[model samples]
Target: MSKLSKLSLITLFFWIVKIVATTLGETAGDLLSMTLNVGCAVSSTILIGVFLANLVTRLLSKSCN
Candidate 1:
């Protein structure tokens, strides 16, 4: 598993991506809701769509051995 228990480099890469994605997502959500004056519901829906797209790609990828 590339030197870590059931944790390959590819898996680690995805993990980093997921973390960064969520971090940016949080920022974007806040900006949309507060700065841009978008309502919470609309911001939430937009974030949900973004999360779902990431979820799809994550699900399609192979898991670590």
Candidate 2:
């Protein structure tokens, strides 16, 4: 018997998108807190709220399947 791999093109695309988005988010966060003088606490709170809102929206949305 041979083992089969489960990874597909769609999965690979999503993984790439996730990595890029995470890197972008981190860079933006650093810029906001450091360059813009927004302060870590304020920037974090704003970002966290945005993240939670997106999470809830995605969770409530219907699945493609």
Q: Count of backbone clashes for each model? A: 0, 0
Q: Which of the numbered candidates is closest to the native, going by highest lDDT?
A: 1
The list of candidate 1 runs beyond 4 A from truth reads 1-7, 49-65
Model 2, runs deviating above 4 Å: 1-5, 8-15, 63-65
Model 2 per-residue lDDT tens digits across residues 1-65: 22323456667889999999999889979988999999999989888998999999889989943
TM-score of each: 0.55, 0.64
Q: Report the Cα RMSD per candidate.
A: 5.5, 3.7
- Candidate 1 structure quality by residue, lDDT tens digits, 1-65: 44675567779899999999889988998999999999899999988998899889888889843
Best model per TM-score: 2
Q: Lowest lDDT 10-mer window, candidate 1? A: 1-10
Steric clash pairs (candidate 1): none
